[model samples]
Target: MSKGWWAVVAVAAATAACAKVEAPAASDAWIRLAAVPGRPAAGYFTLHGGRADTKLVGVSVASVPRVELHLSRMTVGDMMTMDATPAVDLPAGAALPFAPGGRHAMLFDVPPALTPGKTATMTFRFADGQTAAAEAKVVSAGASGPE
Candidate 1:
């Protein structure tokens, strides 16, 4: 091969190596309003991992005053408890589900304007410093959630 061709190939390889990994994605997002007034709402979704492994560190909604990640687990004596989690690990190409009775987001101080059939933008923060925003369908508390 010519020297110029070799140089071109080297540059191409370097560029490929420096390529950025895909950001994480969120789908099937929905927020269920609290069944009773003055209660925290719940948010659920499926977080699709990016091209590399990362940690889901936080989530936020512009309308909501506070949001926190939580895990619901069945404790002893058939009791259920929800614990606040700092982060959730996400492997490459994995789908992490946030559903009822499992991992979910507790959206506190939700505005009254967020009614059923409305949509709210939720931003997912990753450890890699990337943020993914998805609009969450607002549903009534009695609703079964997104399909």
Candidate 2:
């Protein structure tokens, strides 16, 4: 092959290698306020994985005080319960949903300003040092999750 053609091929390979991959992202985030005041609210969202696998280590809410990852499951007695989880797996090119009766986030110490129709900033931390933040809509306790 000609030298000039070889140079062009090398540059093309380099460009493809240097292409940037999209980072993990969070979307459709929303919070459902507790039925009673002073209780923890439920947070739901959709997490889109990046080009690599990672784990969701933690979550933080700008308007709330504390947030914890949780997994809900039904016991042998046909009763449902939720327990705190340290991390949740985030596979590459997958969409993980934090919805009702499954994995979710427990937001504590939510303020009055995060009432219905309001939005709050929620940041998600990943084990790979990647972080994602999204504005979560606030919904009333009696209402279902995001439409």
Candidate 3:
């Protein structure tokens, strides 16, 4: 009887602790304009850490076959280039911005429905085995931001 009672108490405490935990969120998340049958798309947003420092290591979305982190940069010769990045450090309370010509996520094999005015869900994977989810608005091809 005592063993049974202890098991119940432990389960209750674990559930309560998990309920109070909050996951990181993306602020102003949006994807660049891409039409159906399009090659791929890019997502831009801001991530702010809470409680402790974390690292953003990966991203996934059902709408796209594959999603990964990337960085847009200019080479010494003055040509622009985009490359895959492993991860980005996110210090607590600090905002990590992903925008044009900067750090962003590349979504490959996107679905045609991810056009402007449409909403899609994106999941960000952190190094700590925790994940954060966000909804991204597909911005117009010519638009700079979600306007």
Candidate 4:
């Protein structure tokens, strides 16, 4: 109603418009070496959730046939198994961990060029159509993850 009130509202609107929240960021991404070349490899990374909650609907990597989110959990008393999942839910400001012997990505049919000291591009798609891209470095066969 008042001129001062209107000015404050306009400034608030401008600030909100400038702060566009985006999808989570992938950091410390790396691909663990597979004993046999061309075999499936495991990937580890840390997902730093954005200002808003999001869902990881899909993933893709160069020179890889298939990329899927996987979970390793104990089943049937003492046995552990891995299974593919459709999507990964990410809460705001959450730190989702992906590592060996835990939740991680299964990179199927990876090429030999993805050996240690090499890098690969990985694109992650979110449910809102937003995407996050990161570089995945190839680590040693006995390594766990990025430093």
Candidate 5:
């Protein structure tokens, strides 16, 4: 093999290595619906992070006029209360689970007929200024997944 040919091969290999594609910041994210009627609804999902650290800044859906990041906390009075969370951190290769009675998405002003078997398309904004969309299926009350 010639020196020039070996140099070409090295450069080609380096280029290929550097061209490796990265996975998305969030994956396998989904939401489950609550069965209760007439009241504000809650959404649960998982946020999967890629190589870079990210944070869930906000979420939006046409089905709801407002979505807020909320955390259920135990107060000094020993009563459980919900408070708005600024952002949900996403560490590399980690999945953050949003579940009922815990860290969940509070969906306000939802459509009147948001029922089971229907899906709500929600777009999530990340701290890196990228957006990802996920479909959340309406489920019966007390349902859970990772299933």
Candidate 6:
């Protein structure tokens, strides 16, 4: 084989190796609740991927009646808005953070008496049909700290 042909072969092999799907790292994940008046509560967290090409498909919380992934953005008129995101993509070795005024999870219809410091278990579903459970502590709205 010529030198150029060998070089091409090596590059192809490297590319293929890099393209393999890796399992997501479910550890070190957390969600913080943000205060909202007379509406559903919002939570933010960091989703870290152990390997490349992992996407978060769905999320469910036992505490809340319903949970969904929501993306909040500002419209042209400087109005804040939100919409449901089908999925949140987390590339390998990447962390997708849900923060205030950004991507977050919506916990709808929470019980009226729910309070901060309560712990809720959430199951996160990934694109590869894998599910991981994460524990989130409820905090008061505007309580900002490390997630």
Q: What stretches of model 6 exceed 4 Å from their correct place? A: 1-22, 26-38, 145-147
Better of 3 and 4 by lDDT: 4
The sequence of per-residue lDDT tens digits that candidate 6 reaches over residues 20-133 is 766665543344554665467776667778665768998887767788899989999999999999898888788778777888888888775667777777788899887777
Clashing pairs in 4: none
lDDT tens per residue, model 4, 1-147: 899999999999999987977558888888887787766788888888888888888889988889999999998898989999999898989999888888888889887677788999888888878888889998877776665
Clashing pairs in 3: 36-112
| TM-score of every model versus the real structure | 0.87, 0.89, 0.80, 0.84, 0.76, 0.72
Q: Which regions of candidate 3 fall more than 4 Å away from where they truly are? A: 1-22, 34-37
List model 1 lDDT by residue over 41-121, tens digit each: 999999999899999999998789899999999998899999999999999999999999999999999989999999999
Worst lDDT window (10 residues) for model 5? 21-30
Q: Which has the greatest TM-score?
A: 2
**Backbone clashes, each candidate:** 0, 0, 1, 0, 0, 4
Stretches off by above 4 angstroms in model 4 are: 1-14
Q: Please provide, for model 5 over 58-141, each residue's C-alpha lDDT reduced to its tens digit, 9 standing for 90 to 100.
A: 988766888899999899999999999989888877878887778888887777677666777878888888777787777655
Alpha-carbon lDDT, every model: 0.94, 0.94, 0.84, 0.85, 0.75, 0.75
lDDT of 2 at 48: 96
126 in model 4: Cα distance from truth in Å? 0.8
Clashes of 5: 0
In candidate 6 the C-alpha lDDT for residue 145 amounts to: 42
How well does model 3 score by local distance difference test?
Answer: 0.84
Cα TM-score of candidate 6: 0.72
In model 1, where do residues sit more than 4 Å from their true spots?
1-20
What is candidate 3's CA lDDT for residue 94?
82
